[model samples]
Target: MRCFVTGAAGFIGSNLVDRLLAAGHEVVGYDNFSTGQRSFLEGAGRSAGFTLVEGDLLNPDVLRPAVAGCDIVFHLAANADVRFGTHHPFKDIEQNLIATFNVLEAMRAHGIKKIAFSSTGSVYGEAAVIPTPEDAPFPIQTSLYGNSKVAAEGLISSYCEGFGFQGFIFRFVSILGERYTHGHVFDFYNKLRNDPSSLEVLGNGKQRKSYLYVQDCIDAILIAVERADAKINIFNLGQNEYCEVNQSIGWICDRLGVSPKLSYTGGERGWIGDNPLIFLDCSRIRALGWTPKLSIRDGVVNTLEYLMANPWVLDARG
Candidate 1:
């Protein structure tokens, strides 16, 4: 099988690329290096089945060829910086929604039948249902990033129904593993390293959310793409449980041996688009014989350990 993966140099994208190549599939990786690291693809680059392309998703010319002749496309390219969505209002629209438009158009043109997109739990936007299912009614989106994902998901579904494409939309919680670059774990680790005396938290130390390990995340994607048969399949890929922000901070602090005074700035959420609480009901994907093996505590601890061992990622993220 031939796979074209956007954002293939990113944390999850790179891991997915490695997984695909190891499974004897030819992989064409597309990335712009805006946030994705080149070193992340070191192993993928060495694989004979892997081909790396340097390009941005916003440009159709760059995207069209990458999509050509690929059996499947894993669309993971997007502006993942949800915390600062307001800083550049159109970044998410351009990078996520518009980029998805380009992928769909290209896939349609080339007759590519399958696409697996990386959606987010944020699209649920303070969902009314605790442990929100994939079919849960979506409320008003809280963040621009989440809204962009919602738009992308709709486009994929429309394309699937209208153009006969198979779509796998996986709404992910926070993912942790090696090459984990951003999010709460990264923030907490960087803070203690900079100042061990105090750790400044974003929310009121009560923001709780579900998480999945990157490997398990990839497993859910593969499982859905392989086992599930549907014109449009949407799965909430996450752990069976969730952890609070304060709890995660405690775990990170314990691993780092730092007793930093915690300081939280916001009330219910940390930022404009922040969702105070999120826990996805992942039974939809689990029904297809997929369950997360990593616990939230182990994921957090290993994330800290990876960042600790690879201190270069912090500087590289700059």
Candidate 2:
């Protein structure tokens, strides 16, 4: 199969690209480096079956050529930071909504049929159920980032229904693993690496959420692509276990061998659109014969080890 992955240099996208290439598939990767890094795609470039295209999804010229001759399109590009959306709503709108429209349009033009979209658990907002299912009603988004994802999902659904494209939407939880340039784990590691004496947490540390390792995330998408035959299939991708913010801090502290003074701004939700608590009912995806192997502690430890080895951060505090 020939696959085109947008945000191909991002943490999850890069991981997925490697998996696709390993499965003997030709992959064309596209990224603007907005949040993605070229270093993440370096390994894929070395593969004979892999090709990289430098471009933004907002540009049809770049998108159309990048997506040409691809059997499946994995649309992962977006403004991923939830906090950034609060500061710049238009940035999220353009990067997510506009960028997604361009991808769907390009796919339509090329007569491509399948798309596995990278949606978010944030789209569910604050769920009433502990393990929310695919049938769960997605509420009005709490943040601009979440709103943008909701819009993107809608666009994909519309394309599937109106244009007869096969689509799979995976609503992802907190993803943590190697090649991660940003996220809670990365933020904590950098803070402690620079100043081991103090760690500033975003929320009051009581907020809880589900997490998924990068490998598990990639595997779930693969399963979706291979098995999904519906016009629009939706799945919640996450680990079954839930972890609190303070518990995550403790795990990081234990792994890094640093006990810092933990301080937090008082709030349930960390930011404007942040959901304090939400656990995914991954049974939908699990029923498809895929399950996450990494526990919260295991995933955190692995991520810490990766950061220690990679050292993407600088000793600027010194």
Give lDDT tens digits, candidate 1, residues 124-162: 998999989988988987899999999999999999989
The clash count for each model shown is: 0, 0
| TM-score of every candidate relative to the true structure | 0.99, 0.96
**With candidate 2 superimposed using the best TM-score fit, by how many Å does residue 170's alpha carbon deviate from the native?**
0.6
Q: What is the C-alpha lDDT of each candidate?
A: 0.91, 0.87
Worst 10 residues of 2 by lDDT: 309-318
lDDT of model 2 at residue 164?
A: 91
**Model 1 misplaced regions, further than 4 Å:** none
lDDT score at residue 30, model 2, on the 0-100 scale: 93
Task: Tell how far residue 13 is off in model 1, in angstroms.
Answer: 0.2
In model 2, which runs have C-alpha deviations exceeding 4 angstroms?
A: 313-318
Model 1's C-alpha root-mean-square deviation from the true structure amounts to 0.8
TM-score of 1: 0.99
